[model samples]
Target: MRMTTNANRRVTDEQIERARSIDLVQFLQQYEPPGELKRIGQSWTLKSHDSMRISADGRWNWFSQNKGGGDAIGFLQAVHGMSFQDAVRTLAGEDFKTIPTTQAEHKAKPPERAAFALPPKNNGNRRVFAYLHRSRGIAAEIINHCIKNDLLYEDAQHHNAVFVGKDENHNARYAFLRGTLTASHFRQEATGSDKSYGFFLRGSGKTLFVCEAAIDALSIATLRKFDGLDWKKDNYLALGGVTASESKLPAALERTLNTFSFKRVVLCFDNDAAGQTAARRIFTMLRQQFSENLEVQTCVPKVKDFNDQLCVKLQNGKNSPSRGTRESTLSR
Candidate 1:
């Protein structure tokens, strides 16, 4: 085989071929978080980036980003932004050389995940109600509804507003915290929380609205109520956060799809770059996967997010534009 020097490192063609042929899923399982990679049908999807799928044949495709490759070397290059030389060297290491061809052949078990537990509740939710209604402009009824359903509460230790996410059995599986202090911008997920079970409200309607934060979801519900629409008639889900470069279908959104029979999926992400990118990517993935049965679209707020729009509406009175009035919808 021929040899080449890549950035002062000499590599043989046979070694490069070996690196390229390494199993991508096995590589990710070994290097990345094992829990993030989930099985979707016959293919494997990453919890962090659900649009990216690794086939049983060792091929990988990032459907949202419109990028894909045949093997592990290309995966590292595209996803991790690693150079060809570095990707080759990393895969050619002693540990990677003997990667199993299939999941059954891979015998290593993932490390045990920490147990998930909600923070202790405070004496009352006075601070939570005050902060959400006064600062976030969320409606009292909306906050009360969440509290009634045990989805929202005030943590005893820090007085942070805790947004809970539960599984099908109504077991709490995820928690997102937001500081109630005026000067504090603190936000964090509870340790061992699963992103797949994000904060959400299920409605009888067929449309599912997706957002980036718990406050944004509440803001949308508030806006719908302000517009004379029954807020409980439609579903709402928060993804926690998104990045401009992320092409993954969020674990939360994926789980929602599997649980509900939503006919239409409205992407209510932020109006910023990251939000737009995520909305577009998710829109594409849903359309392709669900085909004609599912109507995937984008309904971006005129401002940065739904929370900002809600605040403006409150400041300007009922004369302000309603939820869909100031928003732009993208169907293509």
Candidate 2:
């Protein structure tokens, strides 16, 4: 065993700093075993791997597994399954005397992304309409409004409900599918989907409302409508869902903040523990990243989620027990 001393401390600190500073993208190119890697803009997608998407900033997200991230050190542990000590030593450039070089140095070029495609449209929005309106308790007018705007539809094959996400040019960039059958809870992102442009509903006003699911976002709007609130004045965005290891805020949130000059952010996440944790984490990240003057607040539902609250309200009618007043427009 080696003895611990003050001189050893200086060497250990130097190793940590060097490991942390390694460029993740470059590190992958150098040390990663031969495999299929696809470049998506500045990020790289390991096609053969499990949703390993690495951004230029050294942050990574395993989208398929919903786990991710850290500096170059963590990347090694994740991608190569290295231990902390080995990963650190590798990044500190102390090892690799016997490791084979995988590839010659070459600059990567981003691949041209294919246009987003919606799953085949249903004969009519029949299944989706019934599911959202009758089962989900969303108003007919609200359903019709989304249908008319090309934001929601039913898939032709399985009759799943499709929620669309569009870029600034109004070109569809992502599609989220939800099952409509009773007792079904199937959900997935369509092929070629981009999370940066998640399902968004723009309103006439500047305040923004963010939620975890598309249905929850719509439920909040419906609730606003029921109260005769001007739901159309404020924008809404669904983050798709909360993942345990999502490192930063959703790409959708960042995009919306930059796209619109919104003054207030109301986080309407589900009322459960995971939702509460995500809301708090996102709130902290947004606060640090954006202007200090920007207002940020949480508006969790009284029930499991906004949809549940809306359903209860519909069931209770005017005789429903009084829920506490909410400062956000989503308050019942």
TM-score of each: 0.66, 0.66
Give residue 46's error in model 2 in angstroms.
15
**lDDT of all predictions, in order shown?**
0.75, 0.73
Which TM-score value belongs to model 1?
0.66
Model 1 alpha-carbon miss at residue 285, Å: 0.5
Candidate 2 lDDT over residue span 121-201, tens digit each? 988999999999888988787788888999999999999999999999988888888899867757667766787898999
Quote model 2's TM-score.
Answer: 0.66
Cα RMSDs, all models: 8.6, 6.8
Clashing pairs in 1: 49-248, 50-248, 50-249
What lDDT does candidate 1 reach at residue 157? 99
Clashes of 2: 1
Over 4 Å off, model 1: 1-111, 243-247, 319-332
What lDDT tens digits, residue by residue, belong to model 1 across residues 162-232?
A: 99999999999988888999777676677667778999987888888898889999998888877667788
Q: Which regions of candidate 2 are displaced past 4 Å?
A: 1-115, 243-247, 318-329
